[model samples]
Target: MRIFVWLFRAFIFFALFAFALNNSQEATVRWFFGHEWRAPMVIIVLLAFGCGAALGVLAMVPAWWKHRRVAQRGGDIAPAVSDAPTPTEVQTPSGVRDGL
Candidate 1:
């Protein structure tokens, strides 16, 4: 399984590398403040993709860290409370009461 995953990743990497190599023609990219910069089309696309991926990872880091911390604490967190009453308790039309 691990070998398959590695091979898949290598295949994707080579595919993207080939794409970048094939599409190295310079083109103008518009930026904020009416700025235009010339860069390879593949580089611009990859840069945008890398930035989005980085932002996604950054957003998940805090939640992932919190989960790790809770797991390391060894179940010190409070247990969930059940809405249903205990079997020993008696239910009345008005409310619940202690069982005889």
Candidate 2:
């Protein structure tokens, strides 16, 4: 399974590499206020992807911090529940109740 996953990843990497190589033409990004940035198509795509990923991680920071704070306080996300009988409720091998 691991080998299969690695092969799949390699296939994707080669495909993307081929795409980038074929798309090396210069591209321009027009920003607000009539600003412009120019770079290769592949670099622009990668930079946008990186910025989006950074924003996604930033959005999850508060939830991650909340979980960490709860952990530090020794709180269980889900409390344990025990339903098994106690030792005193067990029956002895001699056919007598242990507690009574």
Candidate 3:
């Protein structure tokens, strides 16, 4: 299993390596007011992917901080409560069910 996993990882690496080699051609990115940026296609793609990932993480920062603050305040997620009485034990086709 480990060998297979390693092989799969290697395959992925080589695939990406081939992609980069194939995309070695230069690319131009146009910006506002006749501004232009240029780089190898692979580098441009990598930069775009990296920036997207970074922006995604940055967008989640507020929610992450809020959850962290709640955790620090000991705000645990309690189980839902019900007014009706629940059975202590019940029989099922597989096995006995005791809510566990």
Candidate 4:
């Protein structure tokens, strides 16, 4: 399994390496005020992907904090029904029970 994972990683690395080598041409990014920035196409693509991912994570920060706060406070969401296991219920080793 480990060897397969390493092989997959190597394949990905070489593919990306080939892409970088093929796209070494300069790319231009023009800003709002006619400002232009130039860099390799691979770098531009990588930076764009990195910034988008970072922004996505940043956007989720508030929701994550809210969930954390609720969890720490024992989410008293809808009151537990008379029969079902509540969120704090202890379970078996597998943490699952067969319905049948």
For all predictions, the C-alpha RMSD in Å is 6.1, 8.3, 7.4, 9.9
Q: What range of 10 consecutive residues in model 4 has the weakest lDDT sum?
A: 91-100
lDDT of 4 at 35: 96
User: Candidate 2 lDDT, tens digit per residue, 9-45?
Assistant: 9999999999899989999999999999999999999
- Would you list the C-alpha lDDT of every candidate in the order shown? 0.88, 0.93, 0.91, 0.91
Off by over 4 Å in 4: 76-100
- How do the residues 1-100 of candidate 1 rate in per-residue lDDT, one tens digit apiece? 9999999999999998999899999989888999999999998898889999999999999988887899898765557887787866846666656594
Of candidate 1, the 10-residue stretch with the lowest lDDT total is: 89-98
lDDT of 1 at 14: 99
The TM-score values for the models, in the order shown, are 0.61, 0.72, 0.73, 0.68
Point out the higher-scoring one by TM-score: 1 or 3. 3
Segments of candidate 1 deviating more than 4 angstroms: 1-10, 76-100
* Candidate 3, 3-98: lDDT as tens digits: 999999999999999999999999999999999999999999999999999999999999889889988999865556766656655345676665
Candidate number that wins on lDDT, 2 or 3:
2
Tens-digit lDDT string for candidate 4 (1-100): 9999999999999999999999999999999989999999999999989999999999999988988888899885455778967877956667677684
Clashes of 4: 0
Q: Of 1 and 4, which scores higher on lDDT?
A: 4
- Model 2: how large is the Cα RMSD against the reference? 8.3
Q: Which residue window of length 10 is worst by lDDT in model 2?
A: 90-99
TM-score for model 1? 0.61
